[model samples]
Target: MKKPTMTQTLLFILVIGIGLFYALKYGNKAKKDIAEFESKKETNTTTKEIIELKYFGEIDLNKTEEYIDVLTNINGNEISIDLNIIEETISKKTIQPTINFLENLHEIEKIAHKQVLSDFKNGNIVKDYIEHHIGEFNDDDLKSLGIKTTDSPKERKQKFLNKIYLKRIGFYPEEWDSLAIFDFTISRDLTQYLIVLSFDSNGKFVDIYTES
Candidate 1:
């Protein structure tokens, strides 16, 4: 075999170096494009569907999983909340509603236990009669004051329904059932709330009574 001259070797080396540089640049660009394509594909694909009183739409449930990942950060297990009803309303509110309102309740309880206790005791709630009269609830029964259990057959659902409403609102008068339902509204100092006060197919609240 003939040994290559100095000039020939130098030119060959330069060509190989240029080829490697282009290969790396092209590989990186291809990777970026693949990432972008995957993100858009995930967003467009639908894996879930739900209906709400006001709005309903298909959602790509696991679409953003890649983008919004938690690294060694376990905040909490995913709670199965009715996202269809609350998602739009929560985004519109200055602060996310239900969770934020619950946070406020915690804060109030922290600062003034007496006031929180007084307010809670006097909290606006559904009348016991209404709750007991709800016919029947699938789950959730009033065990006692400020206590409810979601693991029961619960034939008489009226008072149970009322108690659940009361738990969400705080306290309500006995005559609240007689008055127009439009007057029923709940609020916390920190967050805006929208209580649908909805009923199930059997005229039961079905635990879908509260929204924020």
Candidate 2:
């Protein structure tokens, strides 16, 4: 075989040098990317630790399992605090505020319960109930219940309304029964009415209204 000339040898050496240079550059870049990812992961963990310590004092926030505790018992009503509920309903950005609210939940619960009852009494619950069921019964439906045909529409409606009466509070929607912080079930005899109360992450009462 013929030996390569000086120019070929020089070209080969230059190509090898370029390959090594790029290999080292990309290898270092990959290592740097990994290091940065690890650093960010560590920073996030540290931040979570700080937040837990700042807000919860001695409570262990890093528990891998579900955490639940009895929150308060007011007037025979036993309220429970479930970490899973807060984690699901509350956003990460508002987690701190939500935690702060939970810390004072015992007192807040009483106020919330009272306000809900007051609102139920003073609000449109009765009117809404009447309106909902009044149009439901036709002449045939009323007559089946032994109402006289001579009864006026106004009288027939009043008779229907008379049969209906608000039963009690503390009812929950079938689907969201376990989810809501507070649910007031209003019933007219056999029929069920739903009133859902919503609160913000900061534990401020947002609204209390009936759901269709």
Candidate 3:
């Protein structure tokens, strides 16, 4: 064979150099892609494990759709917690804490009830209710309750407040229906109201409001 020229040798070296550069570049890119894929897989696996372990008996994935229905007994009353999970992915950070909360709902219910009562007495819930529905009470109803229609609004309001006593109708959990985790139905004898309490993922009270 004829000896290769210097020009041919230089061209061969150039081609080899270019090929090696691309090979190294593509090889690094592939390795980076694989690493990222593996990291995502590990993260997903960890999340799945947490959900499975933390919510083992609290929820059944097959039976759950938009929310998890947890039946609980409180003071001999069969109450259910409809924990919301609509448009949510089952994960520890999102759903597990709420499940944990519902697990000890019997105790939490007491705390929530106490807080609601305290708020009702100190807050504007009663005032607002009296303001909104006082007109609904006719002369006969007022007389029966010893409230005079001719009395000043303040006097009437005080009399109404005296007659008002909260009787808890039932505990309704409809986290799926609204932001509130627990909806405590309170009957003021003349009217019914809902004490809607919302909690964070960690079972801390976030908000409380009254609705009729």
Q: Give candidate 3's error at residue 169 in angstroms.
A: 13
In terms of lDDT, the poorest run of 10 residues in model 2 is 166-175
Q: Candidate 3: list runs displaced more than 4 Å.
A: 1-64, 68-72, 78-80, 130-180, 187-193
Candidate 1 lDDT tens digits, 1-212? 99999999999999999999999999999999999999999977655523121111222322311111111211221211122222222222222232333234333222322322233345433333233323332223224322345434343333333332211222111122211111122213322433334322222222223244
Tens-place lDDT digits, model 2, residues 1-212 = 99999999999999999999999999999999999999998866632222342222433333322344334454455433344332313233434555556566556566666665565357765346545654564556556555556977667545644443222222111223232255443233333555556555556666766664
Deviation (Å) of 151 in candidate 2: 22
Candidate 3 residue lDDT tens string, 1-212: 99999999999999999999999999999999999999998875532232342222544432345644555557665555544545434444444455566566567667766676566578876567666666876687678788886899889877766654323322122342233366654233555665566665455666777776
For candidate 1, the 10 contiguous residues with the lowest summed lDDT are 65-74
Q: Which residues of candidate 2, in runs, are more than 4 Å off?
A: 1-46, 50-74, 78-108, 116-122, 130-181, 186-192, 197-207
TM-score of 2: 0.40
The best-first sequence of candidates by lDDT reads 3, 2, 1
Clashes of each: 13, 1, 0
Q: In lDDT terms, how accurate is model 1?
A: 0.33
- Output the better candidate (1/3) by TM-score: 3
